[model samples]
Target: MTAPSEPTDASAPSPGSPNGPGTLAWRNAVFAVFFISGLGLASWVARIPAVRDSLRLDTALVGVLIFGLSAGSVLGLVVAVRLLARFGAPRAMTISVATSSIGLVVVGAGATLLESAPVVFAGLAAVGLGMGSLDVMMNVEGAAAERAIRKTLMPLMHACFSLGTVVGALLGAAASALSVSVFWHLTAIAVLVFLIAVVAVRSIPELENTAETSAPGEPASTWRSRLRASLSVWADPGVLLIGAIVLGMTFAEGSANDWIALASVDGHGFSNTAGAIVFGVFVAAMTVGRVIGGPVIDRFGRVPVLRACAVIGVLGLLLFILAPNDFALYAGTVLWGVGASLGFPVGMSAAADDTRNSAARVSAVAMIGYFAFLVGPPVLGLLGQNWGILNALYLIVALMALAGLAAPAARERHRR
Candidate 1:
């Protein structure tokens, strides 16, 4: 099959045109959103050990606690479409980001004051809810920006997320070493991220026209209509196939986020600070891969690039799992990062190929993709508790293989 056609500039106003400035602003704003989202989430991930220690939790309990985040995220996805419709991307993102920051502070407080697992779980659920909503809004904005600029940028935007995670992880490592309290560390980061989000969201352009809307004479959509509209996307084989591809890939990515640090600590006997640093390395590798992978995808097409990444990821996981020493572990982390890089962004792009149904389709695809997050941690936790954290990663290898099989779904359909 032929590669998808490059987007035409004809449909996009030039920088010299009146709409140009606003478009550029939105692009930058979306980038900031992606960055802060990654930062906030990573900040929480990086401090998992502290939280676990504070609660005196075992792997099984930790997994259950982590479930709260995913549960809240799923809840957010349920309402994100309506929220976007009512508030628009900028306002929605601002509210979501601020709320997520508050949740982070709460998490820190729970750890510091109460050392209560339930309280922490509740806070994390709040974080997840905000993050899930913010995630959809930012992607919607990213899709708009890509069309406006008439270029491929989704991967680069995701790279900004990885970069943010890198920064957050490094900060987390420092905080851990210095015996910085989780309460203070997370609280400070939350405040800073909230301030930045408030300023950045101002630049996001309106998204009322891009996604499908009600017919001219139709009454405003009811909750029933919106629910039906969302559920209907699952009936489309193409959209479902795209969702499947993303599901496996996101499992690979999210598994690393939730487990890699713990793996390094438990399996490799690394200190908590060292483990966080290793996670930072992983995020940094992912950032590099995404930065360079966009052009490769554009040139090679999505199918081949995705399949190749899956193969590489599998090898990385194996090496990390079976290797005898730190060298092999580090190498595996790099390969795994590269391998895990493309699937989610490419899947999002595929889902949004038709601008008319982009919002609904993207939401459907996100729900499937995020299912990995919801189910993966607890499953891996069980596996880790039964066998070992390192052994549990074999599951990711299997998932990556599944992702490769579904990569073809990401192939862009040639427009007639």
Candidate 2:
């Protein structure tokens, strides 16, 4: 198969041929592995309360400790591009995946042995950074792959991630029910992740440099210039608008993924199995949404779809918050999942579509937007601790509405 040019730019004609029907099978397989790896990570988080309780930690301490993962991810995002630039996407992704696998195993091993909170937290932090680096590089490769193939592929790929989460949660719940050690479960997942990474490594294409052409004597961008250039790309009216859209999308998703289980158990009074199921259903809905998202976005355009998703998400959050019973809780989760599914995929697509510096542009928008994920959950957890789960649900509603408001701004950027 032909490879894309180095520093792949969305606007450039790909050096490789567009992905044909013949190649889609292989591409989908690649999506499955990355998707599953992400799902496993999400599943690990869902089981944290059990791990925490096993170690006899309280809610407040758990919140502080959990923040370590997001902190590590943020750190990795800062260095992701430089690493990818030096190693190429294939090598970068492979190495990062390996890093994440090690982290996963570490968490599981610690949990199995009932490691101290400090040690567990450190392991989680390492996992977070590895996942963050892997996430950025994968998306960069994905966008390049999409451009080379001249079609939208991100949604389906991401849909796999959602699906993987759903599956992982189910597996985790089963393991939890059986009183299996968390460490053993995580180690099994790590083995699977490693195998998937080994298989996918061969399929990853090396991207070419399609960045701006400089004169023969023109000096390369200094570190200062490079930093400014990265910042300026996001400073663009179009890019900023996309960042808002992404921020909103992430808010909805991060809220749902991080807290749905907690809400089900603590707020709705469901059994732990039932609570885990709540998360599973939400992820299941999102997975379905991702699968169908690309075709819908292509047919209808990004703006209208995003607006609809936001409205639906708000309605779902309200339903979730107001629900007096488990039936309503499940229904609300379905709504939230459906509404959230499109945001990340579509937002990333918009960023790629609008900017010439596709990789950096996508990265910048993500860097800004994902802070919502890092910040939103802990704040919500604190708020839940302070007020109650019901009140915290209201905050989720507000964030989703804010996300919806930014949709039009993103569209306007495209028009310009």
Candidate 3:
């Protein structure tokens, strides 16, 4: 409710805190926004089976439709460069949430009342578009809040996202078991998610602060300069290196999200329930790692932690790929989860370290990571068709090593 100002509260823990006087409120609000985002995401994913049945589509059709979401997400990130320059974080985040909410409703309507594959695909695209920009903005906001607190909060904040996904997945399961219709279910969740985002945005204090500024204490002209500045982040080798770190880690995480169960089932010869359980183990490991990561980062530092995680991930992934027994398989899954937990959030934090460049840098790094999420799975899928899923995952292991090589790029940005 207050504009950005000097902290008047003498009792404040830090001098000139970036969130002004309401840093705690802003931090909690950011947490809420991140949590609701996860809910919105999982709500759709959890209902895929029911949606497929309702739309009378085969797995092939569903794959094609899912491409719409991935494609839209990539496109949305491109749009985000301008939006961040034009609207800033709070407004852009709000718009993105609204877009995602409306897209969910459209998806619900298409799947239930209309039963048109094209309509559903369009809806998925919209959802992806909205959530994509949202992903960048929220991470930007998270990095801001982390700076305000003068500590490592991004990891725990991301853990909040993981927490949201777990809750959303459970509620969705409950809805399905109760025979809740997809239209009503997605529609209701959409409304809830939208409202949460709207309320959460009120506490953010960024305004158009980063929009007009090129870097800390540097300014840009009205239109062309801003556009050029935003695009220039793509050329910044530092940002690109950080992005590389994110790309490998995200590919590892996304692959797990898409293929862990199947890999466990077929490659390791686990039963259906066991495979699902293995995937669950991975999720739990990720959640735990994120929740604990803040103190670990603060105590040790970003570079060392990231390198260790990369090594752990590579080891875990190798075990999963070449596990000779049940113990090796499960351990690998958990280690992979732990290894992948901190890269995305930590990279965002690093990108946003110089507040002036935060928006463009965060968006660029996010684009790289998100692309891995959207594109990596399918690449692995095609490879898995011939080389086997276990072999396909080796690609991720090599990339993870690359990510390790790039970890130092995410160290604290030198202030000018």
Q: Kindly list the per-residue Cα lDDT of model 1 for residues 48-118, writing each as its tens digit.
A: 98888888888888899889988888787666667777877777778888889989999999998889988
Q: TM-scores of all models?
A: 0.89, 0.87, 0.76
**lDDT over C-alpha atoms for residue 101 of model 2:** 77
User: Candidate 1 or 3, higher TM-score?
Assistant: 1
TM-score of the candidate numbered 1? 0.89
Top TM-score hit: 1
In model 3, the runs with Cα more than 4 Å from the true position are 1-23, 47-63, 78-94, 108-116, 143-152, 173-185, 202-212, 221-239, 259-281, 321-330, 349-363, 384-391, 411-416
Q: Estimate candidate 1's alpha-carbon lDDT, on a 0 to 1 scale.
A: 0.81
Q: Write the per-residue lDDT of candidate 3 for residues 209-285, one digit (tens) a residue.
A: 43333444344345676566679888899999999999888888877765676677657887544654566577668
Q: TM-score winner between 1 and 2, please give it.
A: 1
Q: Candidate 3 deviates by what RMSD?
A: 5.8
How many pairs collide in each candidate, listed in order? 0, 9, 0
Rank the models by TM-score, top first.
1, 2, 3
lDDT of 2 by residue, 129-164 (tens): 777777766655665666667676766667677767
